[model samples]
Target: MSATSFAIETRGVTRVFDSRKGFLFREVSRTEALKGVDLAVEQGAIFGLLGPNGAGKTTLTKILSTLLLPTGGRAFVLGHDVVTDAEWLRPRIGLVLGGERGLYNRISGRENLRYFADLYGLPTAERERRIEEILERVDLSSAADRRVEEYSRGMKQKLHLARGILHRPQVLFLDEPTIGLDPKSARETRKLVRSLVADGVTIFLTTHYMFEAEELCPQLAILSKGRIVARDTVARLRQLVGGDRTLEAEAYGFEDSEVSALRRLPGVSKIIEEEYGPRTRLTLRVRTDEIRPDDVRALLPDHPELEVKERRTSLEDVYLDLVEEEAH
Candidate 1:
């Protein structure tokens, strides 16, 4: 894609940390967080970086948001180079890192946002107006005056998000945004994200939650073993396994022993076991991506009491495919 079409771009970007000092409390050796990587995210799109822990998602987000520099290669946000034009790029992007130290604990949430607003140099009148708007958007209006130190983890996360958006940036980077939130709070955050995207803001999200990415982002890239294994819309990625493959099952007395048998079956790629309201359910990814009920049924004969159900391919399939490829 042309440079202008990309809200964020990176080419062969790499970052390494040297810890040769030997850590009794010190250091040890150089750790490579990101290997050669290339990416281009379109403007106004929620582009997800799907991966498990330590898979370079945060490193990529840090480089794009100007928190960390690449050890080699190039990275840019909104046409501005990360290293040389971080200042120019900074205001155009908002970052909501799912961690501590993003806000001032001594002050109220409103006070915290106002401080950041001033840092961005918003005028007196506009800063207050924007702060009020963001507080409402993040559902922190009721808690706006409470000291951040007293806020719950979810509240802190919301404040971090609010501070990032107060400047009304063109691109927003959210790294594990729902990391520590409760179910209700996480749902609220998802709603807030949808509202922001509807307002024309581009979001770059790094998350391990397959369902979250599946629900929120149409386009995504999976990072595994320090490289991007795949990049595509959720529907397109699901097509990798084909349309004829689905987990067809008959449920009666499903047991833990059934998982192993199911995995050994032809066309079954992965299996996830869960209990729902006292009923045991197994989620499986078929080797083929198509909807072939008979083949799936043919693979299971012992469980006549089993129920026939077809589970659709999701972001988890894409993630598992990447992980599986790495193992081979």
Candidate 2:
């Protein structure tokens, strides 16, 4: 696709932070928060950026939202440069960062919308109309008259969504929009995202929930450290494991020797073990064509007792593979 066909584009976008410490806070070190990252988001696609905590996802989002300047490279939103044309771009993009601070506790949700609508320069008549429409869209119409302090976490999150779309921005940046919500609320938020894309709004979503990205984003980019490790459709990325299938086992106990023994099994590529008090979970990647369920069963230690299951390769597997490769 041509550059103009994209709603958001970046070229070698880089950001560096000068870490300072001391009595006077002198510059002590430099950290490269974003290292020459590049992304091209289609005009009406829900593009997901997945990463671990401190993986530079929020930093990149901030840069694209025109809240911070990049140390190097360039970014454009809706065909307008984020740095040179921020005034034009800001009005066309919406930002919904995860938090409750953006709303005023003393004011009613309706009033908060009114205040933001005014900041966007919407006239009184149009502002009221838009506020009502957005409140209904986010399912906050019943609570619109109540003070923000009275709203639940999910309701507050919905309010954030309503505020983001109040001006009907062409591009929306959602930084962990469902971060603190319950499962039901998060699902609803995902549904709302799909509806907005259906209405022709491009979404740039940053999230740590692998399944959420798998369910919502047709395409995703996995960010690690300060760079993008992989970018493609979830299916294509899952193929990164070649023909390996994940083997998961839940057991009562595990020992270091048993783990070492499992690692020595033929066709086993990797193993990750987790313990939760008395229960333990083990995830293994094995060449499906070469290893059978019986093969895995025969190698298990007899005392611990384990239940084994074969699972399909998922986005999280692909993400870990890429990130681990980058680390090495």
> Candidate 2's residue-wise lDDT over 1-328, tens digit each?
1235579898999999997788765758999989999999989999999998888999999999999999999888887788988888887899999677788989999999998899998888899889989998889999999999999999999999998999999999999999989999999999999999999999999998999999999988999888988888998786665434888777887778877888887777778787878988878877656766566677775844678888787888888878877787
lDDT of 1 at 8: 86
- TM accuracy, model 1: 0.83
Question: For this target, which candidate reaches the highest TM-score against the unseen true structure?
Answer: 2
TM-scores for every candidate against the unseen true structure: 0.83, 0.87
> At residue 103, what lDDT does model 1 achieve?
81
The 10 consecutive residues of candidate 1 with the worst lDDT sum are: 241-250
What's every prediction's RMSD, in angstroms? 4.7, 3.2
